[model samples]
Target: MIPLRALLYRRGTPVMTLLIITVNVLCFLFEMAQPFYLRESFIARYALIPDQPHALTFISSMFLHGSLLHILGNMWFLWVFGSHIEDAMGPAKFLLFYLISGIASAFVQFIVYFGSPIPTIGASGAIAGVMGAFLVLYPRVRVVTLIFVVIFVTTVDIPAAFMLIYWFAIQLLSGLGSLASISNAQGIAWFAHVGGFLAGILLIRLFREKRARYQYR
Candidate 1:
């Protein structure tokens, strides 16, 4: 299932969420503007390479996406779940939560894939954190989702808890499966998703403010 939007209403403008999306988009645009040869170098420089890890790449990697589909999916997930998280935590706290989640995610992936050469790039791990927080805060909220079943296609209003738990399960299972494989050519950072989600679940309470009135849609 693919989430189209959360059914919950917002308490205030999700200023930080929008700003983050803008930054990611701008970064992608800049990435595309580089010459083909230079682009490879640019991505490698900012991406988190577990074999040659850099201090800044943990943060920089979140804004770099490998392709159009990548950024679109990551940004869409962020918009669907992140706005409400930002509202619950406020702008400043939300920013910190996002960065912490991203860094945590990167660390987990680095540990798991130590000495691997593949570059990890994208906002997925950080966005997974937002989804995890949403599950904790609004499990009952319905997510309007796009579902594809065989040849048939449809939309469903899935409970946040169910949707998120299912997503997490997939990541956990995938991560475990990757460990048994010998190739270091894996594309997705499954462990990063898992770690970010767990971090979000653990950290949300610390960053979240007093309960706010739910603006249900």
Candidate 2:
């Protein structure tokens, strides 16, 4: 299911969410504007190389995208689920949550891959954390999702818990499959998604405010 938006009411402006999205978009544009050789150099320096991991790449890599479609997809997910998460946690805490989740995801991927040289880039892991927190904060909330089945296309309002759980299941299964595969081709960091999600689930309570002030729509 492709989640279009969350049905729950939002409280304050999602300033941090918008700021993060803006940063990602600007970074992608800057990356694309570089000449081929320079672009390669930029990615090589910023993108997290699991083998020769840098102190900064764990955070830097989250803002880099491999393609236009990649950035669009990640930003869409962030807008849908991240707004509410930021509303719940407020701006400052939400920012910290996002960074922590991204770093946690990088660590998980590094542990699994060990000395692999593949560069992992994108905001999927951090956004997965936001989705996880949404599941905990608003499980009963409905998410308007676009579903395609063969020749049929439709929209369905699924509970956040169900949708997020389904997503997590896919990530976990894909992660395991990647481990079993013998191919050396670069692939999605499925384990990073899993790690970020689990981290969000575990850390949401710590970051969430003691009082929820948002009004239900």
Candidate 3:
């Protein structure tokens, strides 16, 4: 199921979410504009490689994308789920949550593949954190998802709680499978997704405001 949008709305502007999307898009455009080797070098410097881990890459790599499809997919989920999370936590706390969750994701990947030299790039981990927070803030909220089966296509509004749990399940199962498998064919950081999501679930309460003023107001 492809999520079209969340059926929930917030009163304030989701400035942080928009800022994040803009940054990711701009970074992708920068990556595209560079020459082949130059881009590779740039990604090499910023992308998080588990073996040669750096403090900055943990955050820098969140804004980088390997391809157009990659950026679009990550940004779409960020736009869909991030706004509500930012709304719930406010911009400052939201940004903190994103960075910490992303860092947690990088750490998870690093620990999982301790000696691997492969560089991991993308916003999937941080976005997964937003998804987790979205569930926490709006569990009963409905997500308008597009479902397509063969020639049949339709949209359905599924509860946020269920949809997010399902998503986490996929990430966890994939993570476990990655652990068991000898080959990492997809090169996807399933552990990062799981880590970010779990971090969000654990951190939302700490970041969320005690007396949030914008609940269905």
How many pairs of residues collide in each model? 0, 0, 0
Q: Which scores greater on TM-score, model 2 or model 3?
A: 2
Clashing pairs in 1: none
- The lowest-lDDT stretch of 10 consecutive residues in candidate 3 is 208-217
Name the candidate that leads on TM-score. Answer: 1
Q: Would you list the rank order by lDDT, best first?
A: 1, 2, 3
Please, what are the lDDT tens digits per residue for candidate 3 over residues 60-162?
9898998898988898899888888887778999999999999998889888888777899999998898888887878887889988989999999998899
lDDT of 1 by residue, 5-55 (tens): 989988878999999999999999999999998999999999999899999
Model 1 — which ten-residue stretch has the worst lDDT? 178-187
The most accurate candidate by lDDT is 1
Model 1 ranges off by over 4 Å: none
lDDT of 2 at 93: 98
Candidate 2 differs from the real structure by a C-alpha RMSD in angstroms, to one decimal, of: 1.2
lDDT of each: 0.92, 0.90, 0.86
In angstroms, what RMSD does candidate 3 have relative to the true structure?
Answer: 1.7
* Position 171, candidate 3: lDDT: 89
Better of 1 and 3 by TM-score: 1
